[model samples]
Target: MNSLLKVENLQMHYFTSKGAVRAIDDLSFELMRGETIGLVGESGCGKTSLGTSILRMPTPPGRYVSGKILVDGVDVIPLPEKEVRRNIRWQKISMVFQGAMNCLTPVYTIGRQMMETLNEHSDLSRSDAESLIAEYLGLVGLSPEIVQRYPHELSGGMKQRAVIATALFLKPEIIILDEPTTALDVIVQAQIINLLKKLKQQFSLSFIFITHDLALEAEISDRICVMYAGKIVELGSNAQIYGTQSPKHPYTERLLAATPRLFKKVEQLQFIPGTPPDLIAPPKGCRFSPRCNKAFDRCFQEEPPLIEIEPGHMSACWLHHRG
Candidate 1:
């Protein structure tokens, strides 16, 4: 069977006066129907950039250099902006942005905003739009009465659910969730996570879950893709990523080391020693070489390609491809 989404050699950069910042560099991945791929990385690793580029909504100064964002076998890259907006975006794929409060318009009632979305995307009449708004809100565990309230009227969790509801209003098959549980309290975060799992099962939705939280990613993702300095360092099934076998990429290993694990005895939680390289002037060889404890002569002089380490696991590390 064909993949639901195929991103091949995707490159997105932010053009600045100084130079182009390679936010996404030769990235490639695929999302199958009903599969959740967790994109985990430190901030500035291009996780959000990848999400936005896939949606054909890269912010100003950011533009796609080359690559294909294939949704259901159709490439969205070469399409006209109008066509992408009218057909692809929010129609086949939708995004739930990072901050719920920031994404929602504080000036408008939640209902009005959702109604406007429905109007822009479909021929749904006001009655149909309102019904959808109510149904989606309820699906996200919100009340029908929430339509009357402004964004500020809702709690953090409620605001998040509202954003989720809006994203689902179009019934998109794929959803890119960017740090969906950012600032909410622990309880609300758990609720949101559970809700996402429920919705994924109910709708058979594919998700590109972007976040810095590895533990949370483990809870929701079927596969985990580790990114560093705008490139994917490791991509593997959850068992290969978080299970007994260790990560092949050094970056992945350090990231796992840094995360605090429950029911595990640890004298000290380790941290990756160095900061990520500047995207505009990333290191000459392996982007992670500057910080990789396993870096050697080849690591400093040659960039290793992301190669399959096993049947379903891929890693970009010289150690894995020494030949």
Candidate 2:
């Protein structure tokens, strides 16, 4: 499969009053054409930062610092701000942000927002743009009448559908969905997930789906990348990630144990002890070693590099490296 997007050693650091915070540290991954890769991690683990970095959105105190982001073999990192804006940003890549309900302006009608996005990216006239907006709304299983309503008038699920419609209005090749269903009801969430799967197949769109929900990722993701602190600790197919082979990385195993199984009712559920390390002043070696039950002297002193353990499975842990 051809890679639609390739991110190499991507780093996004924030210079705070305390010190330099490594929000995203040496992250690298590839999105194959029409493949869904789930990025799962606790909040503040650089999932959102990674998505924004790809789109080159305003980072404020955050800086790209280093690394290369290639879209269809084109090095997007070196491109000027204007060129990235005019050529690449929305024309080729788009994002459906978390809290899509709050993302839209309450005062503006759904149709107007979609039109603004369409007109900004393409040379379509008002009528042509309106037609396209209606088409996209319908594509997401939304009624065309919903377009005329203000965001405040729509339900949470409907607002999300409209937001998705806006993101897909340009028909970009890659769409980054950052916890798109987090705020919806369970039934609504399932509906949105189904819509996304349908859209991916219909348009052959590649996606980087960011969420903390492991079970949800297992259902929708082709491959899963488990993140800890500011790095990808494990990358593998869904089966490799979810199967009971005892994950090589202690953190990955803990994450799997934390996932709630529908058929099982246990008195106590396992939880990963201790919170993620502060990025402002991260630990010298493994950020997860403090909480990792399998931590050793080597894990606490040496930062492991991501290495392939199997054909498509990669893990960054001293245990895996030692074996």
Candidate 1 matches the true fold with a TM-score of: 0.97
Kindly list the per-residue Cα lDDT of model 1 for residues 1-323, writing each as its tens digit.
24899999999999999999999999999999999999999999999999999999898799999999998888899899899878888988999988855678779998888888888889988888888888998999999998999988889999898889888877899999999998889899999999999999899899999999998999999999999989999999999998888777889898989999888979998999878999999998899998888899999888899999899999999998667
Q: How accurate is candidate 2 locally (lDDT)?
A: 0.87
Cα RMSD (Å) per model?
Answer: 1.2, 1.2
- lDDT of each model, Cα atoms only? 0.91, 0.87
TM-score of each: 0.97, 0.97
Model 2: how far residue 215 lies from native, Å = 0.5
Error of 1 at 73 (Å): 1.4
Point to the candidate with the largest lDDT: 1
